[model samples]
Target: MAGIWAISCKPCELACVRQEVHARDAEAQLVRLASSDNVLSLIEADAGVLAGMLCSTSDLADDEAVSLIERVAKLVTCPLIVMCDRLDPGLIARLFYAGATEVVAGGSSSSCEPVSSKEACAKGALRQATSAGAVAHSKEPAKSASGMDAYAEPARQVHDRTAFHYASSMTTALDEPDGLDEPDELGRSDELEEPDEIDGLDEVASRKAMGGRSTSSEPGAPVICAIAGRGGVGTSSVVGLMAATAARMGLRTAVIDLDLMHGNLPALMGIDDPVDLARLLKDSDSVSETAIEATAMMVSPGLTLWGSLERPELAESMGTAVEQLIFALRDPADVIFIDTSVAWGDAVAAAVAMCDRCLVVGAPGPTQPESAARIAQLAARLGVARTKMVSVLNRCTASSLNEEFALRFEMALSLHSRVRIPDGGSEVSGLLSFGRLEDLARGESRLTSAIQTCTSSLLKELGCAVPEGFGKPSEQDSGGLRIRLPWDKAGEPR
Candidate 1:
């Protein structure tokens, strides 16, 4: 039968698909399936009867959409076209990886005031399906202009030679070389014998299944990773302050929020509505320098901010997307800072390994040192050199106990470089309330001096040319720092 199957849970999308299908081919019947399971069932029952499938992502989650497309592609001979509200490069790549023949954007789910060219998009989908029979036997995954397979799973793409070691550990016994086999007394190879289980192999497998990039191809920005030993240790604040300090010194700086789940970089930077990274990923055709520039939110003349995921649950699946984003930002800024969560996941591991400097931030406490030690050990396993790591103790007071904690943290982290930021007292709270955390580097307080010192030291370590007058206090009346206390009037500064 000359018919098209429309798959969507949304009524609006289904109606749009019906209208587009009828407009394209009046004689072709449009069969609407409300769920992926229904479509799968139909395909199983009569795989040869279907002409094509028009799937919409509006009704399914990103992972769900990918899974459905992959399952359907494996079962059906007809073309599988995906209709998304917007064309996100990451989503498109995933869909293509799952064997989608074509992806069309600007459907009924589009947020644009006037819906974009649905007729043309629908016509293109129909045309692609019409030509599917001629090329069905020769279909291959899409490749980028760089000749790299664009649809290749990012996890499967080895970033460097060291990746082979990690890959080897995860490889199954079946993948082992035949050289590992030995002949027994009966003259049969021992290849079929059950091997002894190794300790921590299951944990390694779990992490591998979870997910986790390089800095760039060319010599560009020195990437820095700011990771916390635990939550509330002020890692993000430190990154914001350091990046802002460097930018204020006339250096082009960028901060990427690698904490895909619960990232607060926008709020800390006083940006009420930052660009949604997913939208930027969709709008751009590729992960080039221009695409990264479009994704960045210009905080000031020299500083830029790249936000995290709009949906926190999608963080697990966004490791590759984040890596690609970091790679794209290499040439756009002179220095790059990555703010990562405390959780030790694939994304955090990748960031720690790829950066020029690893800023391990922790609070002054008994447990923080142990946490920092664990992070250091993990970074070592991930191929980060000890010399590249720098430990920072936040909220440090001049008391003897706090000083002792600082020594303990540094000793545990085992890094030559260390920085201590004094507790900002009430002033820090006021700045946070006002969404002016970046101003921590703009005052004469101990916190500001520590931030500037850290920024200068890291830049110097990376061989980045520091401006002639960098880290010096400005001459426009070096007045005492003024901040509005919570008890004071709204317009007053103490």
Candidate 2:
């Protein structure tokens, strides 16, 4: 049974279409969108096809619709189909370019012409001729050339393999209600529900069984600082992934976006108003668990995020405040991953100096080797142990290039690179790329396997015992326990 989530204006024709689709496809589960603001939350909650129905042409021109489609295509790795009154060639082309899987036409004037047999025969051709009769009278410019001519066929070939179906029937519209309320800062809605536990793995009990100790008695959580030799080498992405990996393992994990100048962790994690580090740091006495909880945004189970401050001037004042917050969170979280800035600053240096383990991510480029060496020098100067520092080669797949990365690491930083993450390509690249990577980690892939190995290595470095079957579904099934506690809804500690 396919699940279809349809988004339309309130009191629009989508209600009828939803019912008809459910009737036609008995097994299909149809979910309607309540508001445009909850797109990410809805995507995370539901797993299936997304159908955006635009009844009026004006609705197609709405910025919200276009933005919604673009974000869904980029962030949600699912099939996106747009249902409209007529097939506007330019709009269809742009939608495809924006990542829509298919476009369907319906309404009173359903005169959609089938693709020409000759045009269909052409390999990887996407550009179809505009409707000659009706399109001539329309305002849109004529694009008579093959759609495939302008757009690259090979890039879209994978997406074009599937067939499309247009809805020919119309339904009565419903009464229009007041506008939907604005979405929460985190984009959470009351409609969103918690995800199922990972294969019945009792997170707390399993950790207890392994004799994992709480950090409450200590002053700080285990800090894993992911530093990069240069910017745009996928360092932030790696940090975000590591944090997610740990959180999924049921370790209380928090990701602090220390990249004040150009931080995108909030965007990557789909958090709108993540903890304002600058504001939180203003009060010297506000480093308590309550304060942290009030400021931080909960991303998922066991995952919390402290996003960067927009003001770069606050970076100087943040050195002590950041350190204090790190210490404060120790009792609440088991692990804290810091996404440090690209350049070496006082704050970055302070963070590196304070970290229990440092992951230096360097690209396979000209200056990255020297940059790695500089990081090593700084770590050594700050009295960090050599064994605690690990190096990673980001986005290099070729064997020869990996070897060069290894050679560079050892020669420059006196550290042999342990992890080399392959560029997962377009299928895994986007604003919410970390979520996609986390999904990939659930399945069998070289990337997941590598991530597992790296995680194990880091745990060993931290003197934590690796379970017999880490990152796997536990054999123990407790028959699905579901006890509702007062704070269970928010997943916050009492």
lDDT of 2 by residue, 165-212 (tens): 111000110111311111121112222222232111121111111111
In Å, residue 382's CA in model 2 sits off its true spot by 1.4
Q: List runs of model 1 lying over 4 Å from the truth.
A: 1-218, 280-291, 398-401, 472-494
Report lDDT (Cα) of residue 138, candidate 1.
15
| lDDT, residue 142, model 2 | 27
Clashing pairs in 1: 87-282, 88-282
The sequence of per-residue lDDT tens digits that candidate 1 reaches over residues 1-494 is 46655455477665556544443345667777878899889998988777667788886899999899877766664546667776464675467445565555536656311111223222221111111111111111121111111121122211222111111221331133431122221111222132332112222211211111211233445678887767888888889899888787666677888787888988888888876666444533334334455567867667788877787776665554565555445544567899998775656655664565678889866698998888766654443434456788887763434556778888887565677777777888788767787775687776787677678867865656665656554442233234547565666554
Q: Candidate 2: where is the Cα deviation over 4 Å? A: 1-220, 284-290, 398-402, 431-437, 440-443, 465-467, 471-494
Candidate 1 least-lDDT 10 residues: 128-137
Model 2 whole-model lDDT (C-alpha atoms): 0.50
